[model samples]
Every structure is written in structure tokens, then in C-alpha cells.
Target chain A: MKLGDPRKAYRIAQGAKVRLNEDDAADMSLCPEGGKNSTQGLFDSLRDRIQTLQKVLYAENKRRVLVIIQAMDTGGKDGCVKHVFSRVDPQGVNVKAFKKPTEDELAHDFLWRVHPHVPGNGEIVIFNRSHYEDIIAVRVKKLLPESVWKKRYQHVLDFERMLAEEGTTIVKLFLHISKDEQKRRLEKRLENPAKHWKFHVDDLADRKRWHDFTGAYEDLIERTSTDYAPWFVIPADRKWYRNLCVAKLFADTLEDLELNFPERDFDPSSIRIDD
Target chain B: MKLGDPRKAYRIAQGAKVRLNEDDAADMSLCPEGGKNSTQGLFDSLRDRIQTLQKVLYAENKRRVLVIIQAMDTGGKDGCVKHVFSRVDPQGVNVKAFKKPTEDELAHDFLWRVHPHVPGNGEIVIFNRSHYEDIIAVRVKKLLPESVWKKRYQHVLDFERMLAEEGTTIVKLFLHISKDEQKRRLEKRLENPAKHWKFHVDDLADRKRWHDFTGAYEDLIERTSTDYAPWFVIPADRKWYRNLCVAKLFADTLEDLELNFPERDFDPSSIRIDD
Candidate 1:
């Protein structure tokens, strides 16, 4: 087996897991193992930026955040949600992961199911898997008509526009991972008994349609990346790099909003009381 | 001044703030403060309970939580949201404060302004001030006629019942502060420069009808407390005690739900491969 070249189309003739320990995985350049911590500075800067933005955001009560993550299987969505938002004030943030619709949910329009979950003013809402799934997974699984899936593009754009108009700032990310990397992750789940619970046989069916999902994503990004909600295509082949990219983007988005506390009229004499 | 007896009705004169830092303030005969601290422990346990519930609720695709906080002015609604839920995983909670409605919001049904912000399943949604104001503040301010405000009592019950039917566990709290204590807080706000921003002339206007507000609250508790969502009247003369009561109720509610992670099958060889 040979290490795939980043310059060209990397191909794996045999489907096998790539064993990456923390030490070995430190080589993220897609070259020979040159041991260096490349992600530390990116994460540190992100943490600081988030804190400052948070103070402003909580006080301002003017803006809202809606983070939409679209990814292939095992693209580190959970890990990103945990580590990136670890220090944020829980009171002002929310995470919503859209899964297969329940009976009551299926009775409504697709957007109806998700609308209630969007953050209000002075909030940050994360959609772990979002409306894109209707276009990506449901389309791949043929769960909906080609016409229904195709029409959702316009519906999604309109929905996002409404949110943006109403003070919700949207940041969408597509986590791009190579087929080989995904296979390796799927295998690791089988090896660790503790993690074996996370592996689902149904997930492989989704894995088989990888290219189709990517094509759907590429189209979704191209079409839905509007002035209000732009999509960031992150290279998620390296988990550390992926987390770093997301953290920076998340931090940058909040900072760009210029959140701050409203000005208060002060009366200094009010604090002193002669008993 | 002689301490008033806890056994009878004590006159709380107009504009006079009660000082309860003495023996009278320590009257916890019916339900002692020690028991309340244990309830505080129960509330602290909610953080862990919510974490476990998340895995199941996210997988099950149920996203809904509605937390209602109702109290007298300066009853620690903001503080409860900040302190009780401080340790919640930031990714799963949303907080909304409902102040006086804007012209647009007033044009719609009372619940209409609130429906959009309900928590998606696996997400905890909090209302710092809720739809109950349709009756309480509106009634006290003479903003609505008796016919309208009285009708709202039944409307609120139906509204909350609908939420519970949709799988939201409603936890309602009324921070019960004595009138004398309210005056002291108002004076403190007036005397402190930093605190001056919190006090407004309108607050004094609300205090003028304090008895009327109390009567409205008594009626509300009697009519609204049901099996689906029980109301807890927290003795809130002490801020720390108020937080403790709310925290205990919150923790006990989630723990009662008995949340647990779903078991998954493990296969070791399926996940491991070498380069």
C-alpha cells in the first residue's frame, strides 16, 4: 500500500481502515510523518475569539447564529460540537440534530420541523444534521421523489432568507472527507468494544452512496451559498484541521457581527446611602 | 422596630422595604431551608440527567423543552436561568426573555409570539418571562379588560396542555418575595450607581398595585397547577434560596424522566485494519 498523493486523485484499490494514533495522526500534511502540532494555535485563537464574541452577544441581544453542518458518515460532527463550544455559556447556545422524521413531524412541511429549533435573538443554534439531509440522504435513498428533492433547493433558500431577514446569521459547513478516511473510521468503531455501540450496519448503505452524496452537497453549496448564509467547504480528511477550520469560522462569524452591550445611563450617586 | 410575628398578617407599609436579615427572616417552619438545600442537590443532578437524555432524544428525533419562570418583579428569573442551567451542555439549551410585546407581536395571538421559540426535542427551551404575562402584568396594568384577562386563564391552561401533549415537560416557578423585601431591593438599586440602571420609575408604578398582583398570582397558581406541569412557589426573599429551589425542581423533573443510552452491538474485527 502506498500513501496517496494530495496533488493527484488519491485512490485506494482495497477498502481498509487507516490506523491513525494521536502520535501518527499528527502528520496531517498527507506526506511522510513530520511530527508537529499544527492545530494548537488555530484552536487557541478560536477559543479567545469565541469568549469575546459571547460577552458581546449576550449583552447586545440583537443577533442570532444558525450553524448548519453537512457531512458524510463519521465526519466528526459530534466532536466538533463538544470541543468547539466547550467554554461557551450554555444559556445562550443550542444544538439541534435533525434525524428521520417522526409520525407527527412527517405530517408537516420539512422546514416546519426545523423552524422551531432555530435560535432566537442573542442565541447560537447548531444544526448537527440539517435540511440538507432531505436533499442529500433522502435523495440518495430515494425516500422522496426526484421532483420533491429538487424543489427543496428553492424552499431551503427561501427559508434561509427569512431567517437572515429576521436577525439569524447562518454559517453552513460541508465536511469533505475521502472515502478511505471514512472506511478507516467505520472500522475503528468495530474494533473498540466500548465504541462498537456507535457503529450501525445501516450506515454502510449511506457510505455506498458517497459520491452521489458529495455531488448533492457540491450542488447544494453552489446553489444555497447566498449573501446571507454562505457555505464553507472544509477539508475534513484531517479531523484536527477540520475542527480548527470550524472553530475559526464559528469564532469569525460571531466577531463579524460586532456584538456589544447596549449603552446604559448611569447615576453614580444611586450607589451611596447615608443610614 | 419590633420584629413582626410569622403567625399573623404583618403590615408592609407603602414604600417601606422590609429587612429580613434577622430572626423573623429565618422562619422556615413549614418547609425549612435545609430541605430546600436537598432540593438544590436534586436540581444540580439535572445536568447529568440531561446529558444522558440527549443521546436518546437526539437518536429518537424528539426535540422539545419548555421551561417557564414566573415571579414578582426582581424575583430572580434572569438569575435562575443563569445559575441553575450554568452547567448545561451549551449545545442543547435555548433561552427566551418575553418583555412587553412590540406592536407587531401585540397584533397576534398571545401564544403566537411564543410558538416560534419552543425547544426542539433533545433541546431544553427556557422562557425567562412567558405567556402568563397576558394575565398578570396586563391585568395589573389595566392593559386588558377583566373579560379578556379572565378568559386568558383558561386559554393559558389549554396552551400549556398542548405543549405537554407535544412532549414538553413544563417546569414553572414563582419566586415568592415579600413586599417589604421588594422595597429594600428597590432602595438598593436606587442607592447604587451600577445598580441605578436596573431601577426604573415604572417599577414603582407596578409596586403600587402589588396586592392586586398578589391576588392575580394566587388565582393563577390554583387554576394552572396540573399533573403535566406542577407549579412550585419558591420563597424568594433570599436570592440563593430561590436559585436552589428552581435548580432542585429542574433536576428532579429530568431524573423522573429516567433517561438512558441505547445499547449497541459490538464487532471488533470489523473496525480494525493496518496500513
Candidate 2:
């Protein structure tokens, strides 16, 4: 399957598959034809192209693009944004990383805090662990009742549909890594002094419920993927391949829009300098 | 007087000053030597130096810095922040621009919305048109009754003293521009096509009541300029000079604290990689 169209290949076909990454990690490879070294160079070139396209995108100022990245712990979401989107002009792009909600955020509906940070026309925004967490985390941990959590799937669909109809292109990616890979990353974090701040004891408790999390992920993917805004499950054990695939998808989606510089209606030749 | 101590240079002595810039602009100059070209270079170097101090401040994690800049329309408050603080690490600095209150914010006390954004330790926060607006704008425009606005002066003094005692360094600047200079700026906005969006018809009405604004500004600066957070009147007719002056004040204040790099407990030789 073409790597650009990950939906057909990675979309959860079974509503009742009831597992996250149940297939072997070896089976989900989506790297284009190249050695690891060559693909790394290609990723750099794609990032440069994305930066150039972003200037035109800002000038055109017609549509907004929102990229939602959801991943398990130690799943390289920060690494993907830093490596891929850092080259773009900061004025044109905004990155909102949703941590724990605050008192005001809890006072309103789940979408209250997320709504204020949505991208405007001619803007590119990335949500690191976005509204999906409102559903996935609470569901798996049993933080909310089954009746409350189950109804959120339709709310998610309607929100995306409204945004899509109002000229937003939403690309949601679920970073899929093997359970063994997460264990290795967690151990590495504990061993490395520099990464110790990132390690939490509660994370070990969350790790214990790996199966429940997998079931929640499979259910969300089956229910929420739509034509207006589809979900793609990207193999994320290898950082280089994950960044390369996200950047490729971003570039392709923006290029399809055919953005152009805004029209300037003045005669520059007639203006004199040094007045 | 030393340029580093703008308090002596511009602080109002009595409950009133004859004018915002009563002396010659040449006398009010804070830029050191080499004319305008070199002052611009000095601003850049100070910005770089401020960036260095911010790193230590973040590591120290003991004190917070709050910068409050209040000015009339087209009074160079935005320009000062862009030129002075933009180079600081985005993680350490936040700029909050408060406009007309939202319905929810209005439902609460005036200080409710403003109190939440105060910086924590190891952070710098800038308020562009802050709570001081509660007194100046409302009093001049008669948005609130005389009895209600009169009590705000003491309230501001107490609020600022509490913050100062709790370990926040407050720097307040009133960007003082002449009414004539403001007229020229407003006219320039009309003549320049790119700046038309910033020009508003209501601004002309504000210009009509420049005297009332001046009276309100004089009163607030007198009532609220305690030793804890004294206000400086910056001569902002020249953008370059204004930026240089503000950056200088910031550098001198932070330097007086004598921040130190945090001690490293783990020896470099003890921690080995690639196990």
C-alpha cells in the first residue's frame, strides 16, 4: 500500500478486534524504499519543502490545518514536532500541548479548553494529545461511567465534521508502538539521569493496564474515523520513520490545496525611495 | 542622573507633572553615545544579555518578574515588547494583552481575570494594558461612577504590595507620548495601506478627550507609584530610544539580583551512557 494513504492500510477494520498492535511489530512497516540513512536525509528535504509551503499557506489565508497527534507514553510526539515542524516560521504555526486541565477548564464542557486554541485561517496548528484524551484515557481508566464515555464517540464525530465543513483539514495520527518497546523506553528513562523528570511512579500503574488501553484504542479507531477527518495508525517504534511519514503526509495534504501568494494591487515601479 | 535609574529622570514629583515630557527630548535621551545607529545595536546586545540572565533566573526558580506597560493608542507598547522581550526563551516569558472583558470575566470582580496570569518563580510575565486600565480608561471615559473608581487606587497599592512581598519584581512603565505625536501617528496609519487595520474611527473620539486622559494618567501614577512598584514615564516619541530605555531598565534590575547557575549534583564522570 502507498505510504501516503495510511487510512486504507492502518484503519481498524474490525469493530470488535479488541486489541492495540495485536499484530507483530514487524508486520506494520510503512517506510518508503530506502536505507535508514537515506530516508533520514529525505525527511530533512521534506521538512524544508514543508517550510516553504507554509509561507504560501500563510499568504493565501483561506484554510486552516489541524494535526492531532495521540500516542502512548514515551511515544515520541514531542520528538516528531521538534524534528519535523521546527523549521517552519513560528509566526505561522502554533503548538498547543494539553496537560492536565485546570479549574476553569473543568468548569465547562470537555471541549471548552480545546476550543480557544483552534487554528485560524492561514494557520497550521498541532495538538499534542488533544480531545482524544477526553475519551481514551477516562474510558480505559474507568474514570467516568460507561454510559458517559460511550456517548463521546458521536460528539467527537460531530465536532470534526463541523470543523471540516468550515474549511479545516484535520489529520489525526495514532502513534502505535509495541508493548515491549514502551517497556524498554521506560527502563531507559529510569536509568538515564537526564530523563528522570519524565518518569512517574503512576506511569507504572498505567503500564499495568496495557490490555485495557489497547481495547480502548481499538474501539475509538473503529468508531471515530470518517471521510471528513480520518485517523491513521503510524508505526512509531523507530523515530526516524515516524517523523518521515508524518512530514510526508503533511506536505502531501498541503500541496493538494494549491496555495498561492496573496494578490498585491499596487504599482511598485512608480514609488520612489529616499523621500 | 544615570540612565539606569529612570525613576529620577521621569517619575512625577507631586500629584501631577506639568506634562508627560516637559523637558526637551534631547535631555530625556537614555541611549548612550554614537547616535541612533549605535543605540539600536545596544538594544540588541541588551536583549542577548537578558536572554542569558533569563536562563539563570529559570534555574534559580525563586523569584518572578512582572512588567506592566500602559500607553495610549499607537504609543509603542507593542513595539517595545517585540523589540525587547521577543528574544527571551518563550518558555520563560509570557505576554498577556487584555482587551475588553468577556461576559464571564465581567461577571466576576475586576481583579479575577488579571490575578490568574501572574508569573510563577523563574518566569517573566508582561501585561500589555493591565489592571491599571481599570482606573485610567474607565475614569477618563466615565464608564464607571466617580465613587466606584476612586477606591481602586488603594486597592491597586495593596495588591501590588502583596505581590512584591511574595517575591515578584514589578516594573511599571507608562509610555508617554505627546498629543501632537499621536496625531501624526494616527494620520500616518491612514496614509499607509498596510496599517489601515490598526486605525479605528473611535480613536478620533479618544483624541478629542486627550486632556481627560492626561488628568487620569497623572492621578493614577501619583496614587499607585509606591516604593514597591514605582512607575516610569518613558518618552516614546522616538521608537528606538523608547526600546533602548526599557531594555536598559530590565537589564539593570535583573543584574542587581545577581542570579547564579544552579549547582550540578551529579558528577559528569559518574553518569555513563550507552550501557
Candidate 3:
């Protein structure tokens, strides 16, 4: 569970079984006890780098980045987003939270509801939950037949590959948290006076079928983790470690692109005022 | 000119001549000399009111507000927007700036480029420059014949009426600035090293056609300022006064709605958590 080489270590192996229960929930070596100060120092440096990279991406207006985050209940997706992307200008980033599909959305093809939310040139788009739900949710709940739902994995791969060919950098993250920790978090949501509004009876029903959902995620991570669009399974019981891992991945992805300040279109010396 | 009774004072007269040069550019009587302090006090108060009202609007999720601001070059449209809307939540408000229409946009009816940007339920959308530009820009530059452009005033009125009937409160403001003031601002944009990038060569050509453009705006303000959606001819010579006046209009408009918190769908006294 050491996050030594996140790109290689944490990325889900192509053909290996993703046993969600087997993974360590809290890796203390990655995040030492009482380590908020040291973790925040690394986070600040990484966050500042993302802010600068985002500006260059905006100015270049050539490449697009889409970050898709999927998580179990109370798995800290929001916290990871806030800490990692807080420094980037809101104008440059568009966050779309995919809720239950509307009646109109249901009428269209599944990707139809998701396609329009994709990032445009020089933009960064974060999908809080995304098209992957078509496979996992439907499969877990038997919303669609096995024949229909199984084909979506290939469709998802093709759609993402087309986007890559057209200049979109896709990064998908499946935040990994233990089931026992999820119960703790969900119980906290009900116990905290301020968090009563966040709880739903349906979450309890989903938690009851936790093993089924894990099996669905297991297949999802194995089948859809393409070379062009890899899925990173981050250790998420520790919020600080999750933030650092996500931020570092983003910084590395951006830096690897070799972004440079765009060449000026006009000569600065020629801007003479007649007045 | 005093800015008292802004809803009554600044709302353009239905049949009055909107002679740009003849209108008061410096409404200093409303703001005393060296009185930025007092003007800011009024602005701060109004801005805070807008912030509160906007949250109520979001909570109620019923009505929508669309603020259309049209101004000539260096006419303080951006300044007016920033000062008036500085305190509102970025999520609750949307700002859309219409630049030169692309070829795809020009292929459709003029309103085609605008209709998609309209406010949705419980939202406030500000159009920095809007479909009114179809009437003003093309009419001034003779991009289209009079036969084509003349028909659009009725089209504009009809569009605004439909929006009004559909629970959207539309406030269109014509930021009124004198030609002399525009020249001074444009000169500043060219002379200031930091602002050199904002200066464009086409702006000089547009400045030369100031009189022709005013005539176009004159007809636009007269024909389209209807009861359903009135145009406010804000005196833009003084930036702080313009901000205060616009903020007051928005605050008054929201206050008139008598917005209340939406009735809760669930009881807070429900069964306690087992945890």
C-alpha cells in the first residue's frame, strides 16, 4: 500500500483481480500519525504547480484534461477535489456533478447525457461521477440485462480513445476505502446534527449490498482501464494522503505534457499610441 | 443629475430622445466631489443585499434574473458587472460574454446565438453584451440592409416579452458614456503598459463611427424598452455611481419579489439515528 510509484504502483493492473476488501484501508507509512503539517507542505507545493499549469493550458488553448472521480459512499471525493483543485481558477475548470439521469437523459443514449459535459480546448473538467455508472450501477441493481450492460465497457473505451485522438487527456480515479470505514463514515453522517440532511435511507440499502457493488467495481476497473486512459485506485481512508496522491498525479501529468507559455501573436514594441 | 429613485430616475423614458451626447455624462450632483467613500458605502450595502437575495432565489428555485448590459468601447460595462456582482456566489450567478459570432452562429437566426445562454430556474445570468448587439452592431456597421435589421426590433421586443412571461425578470442596461470619456478610456488602454494587450486595432475603427453607433443605440433604446422588460440608461461617466445605481436596481427588483425560504419537504423531528 506504499504510494511509492503512484503511476505504476497504484494504477489497477490490467488483468489482475481488484479485490476491494483486500487492500489496506489506512497505510500509515504513506501518512504518518499526526502528519497534517508535513502533508500540507507537500500539498501546497503541488497545488501551486497545478495553478500555474492550468494557466498555461488555458493560454495554449490546445489541449483538454478531463478528471473522472468515482467513489463509494463517504469516500472523500469532495475533499480530494477541494484540496487538489482549490488553487486552479474556477474559470479554467468546470465541475459537473452527474446526478440521477433526467427523463430526457434517459431517452437518449447513455453517452449522450455525458458527452456534452466533456472539456473543451484549454479547459479542465472534473466529473464528480461519470458514465462509468452506466456499467456499475446498472449491473449492481440489475437495471439492464447482462447482454446490454456488458457491452458498455467496450463502448466506454472507444469513446475515451476517440477523445484522446482528438486531444483530451483523460485521468480516471477510483478512490479506494474499506467497507468498515464506510460504515463508520455513514454512521457519522447520521449522528452529526449538521449532517442529518446528507443521509438518505437508500444509502443503507446500497450498503447492505456492498459485496455486490465491489464485484461490479472489480469488473469495471479491470475491463475499462485502458492504456490511453488508466484508472488509479488511490488509498483513501486517510484524507491527507489521498489529496497528496491526486495532486502529485495531476502535477506529473501536466508537467509531462511539456507545457510552455504560448508564443505572443503581436509584437510588444509595436503597441505605440498615437496620442 | 441626482441618482435618487433609480428605478424611476434611471429607467429610460418610453418616448424620450436617447441622445447620447445630450445626456448627462457626469452625474456628480448625485455624488459629491471627493465622495468615493459615501458612494462605496451605498455600493457595499447594496452588494450585500444582492448576495442575500441571490441565495434566497437559489433556495426558492423559482424565479430567474437576467441582467443584460450593453456598452460601447471603454464604456465601463465590465466595471459595472464586477462591482455590482462581486459579492454573489459564483455558483448562483453566471456571466456570459458574447464576442463576434462564429460562422456557425451566423448561419442561424441572430437569436439562435443568444437563446441558449438564457437563465434557468433560480439562477441569475448576466449578458455582458447580448442579442441587442444584433440590432446595434449590424445596423451601425451596415452589416445587413435596413430591410433586415429593421425587422429585428420587433423580434427583440417579442423575445423579451416571452422571457418575462416565463418567470424571468429581465433588466437591460445601456451604459451611457460620452464620446470624450470613451476616447480618454481608450487612450488609457493604449498608454498603460499592463493594458496594452486589451487594445485592439478594430477598436479605433469602431471609435471613428461613434456618432453612427449612437444613432443605432438611440433607436434600439426607444423601440425595445417595453413595459415587460425596460432598459435603464445608466449614466456611466462616473464608475462608482453607475455601480451603485445598478446594484440598487437589482436589490430593489429582488426585494420586490418578497422571496421566502422554500417550505421543507421533510420534518426535522423524524425518528432518531440508531447510531
- Candidate with the greatest TM-score versus the true structure: 3
lDDT tens readout by residue for model 3, A70-93: 988788876677668755654566
Cα lDDT tens digits for candidate 3, B1-275: 23466778778766666666645766645555456665666777788899788877876779999999998988887667656775565456666778898999999999998998798877888998999888889988889999998999989889989999999999999888887777778777656554554567788788878789888888899888878789988888878778878888899999998987666444445633332
Better of 1 and 3 by lDDT: 3
Error of 3 at A203 (Å): 4.2
lDDT of each: 0.68, 0.76, 0.79
* Best-first order by TM-score: 3, 1, 2
- Candidates, ranked, lDDT: 3, 2, 1
lDDT of 1 at B188: 74
Cα lDDT of model 3 overall? 0.79
Rate residue A141 of model 3 by lDDT: 88
Regions more than 4 Å wrong, model 2: A1-69, A73-97, A101-109, A112-128, A139-148, A160-275, B1-19, B22-28, B39-65, B87-93, B101-108, B119-124, B164-168, B251-275
- Model 3 misses residue A193 by how many Å? 9.5
- Candidate 3 accuracy as TM-score: 0.77
Off by over 4 Å in 3: A1-56, A73-91, A173-204, A226-228, A232-264, A268-275, B1-56, B74-92, B175-199, B226-228, B233-261, B271-275
How does residue A27 of candidate 2 score in lDDT?
44
Q: How good is model 1 by TM-score?
A: 0.70
Q: Best by lDDT, which number?
A: 3
Clashes of each: 15, 0, 0
Chain A accuracy as TM-score for every candidate: 0.84, 0.91, 0.94
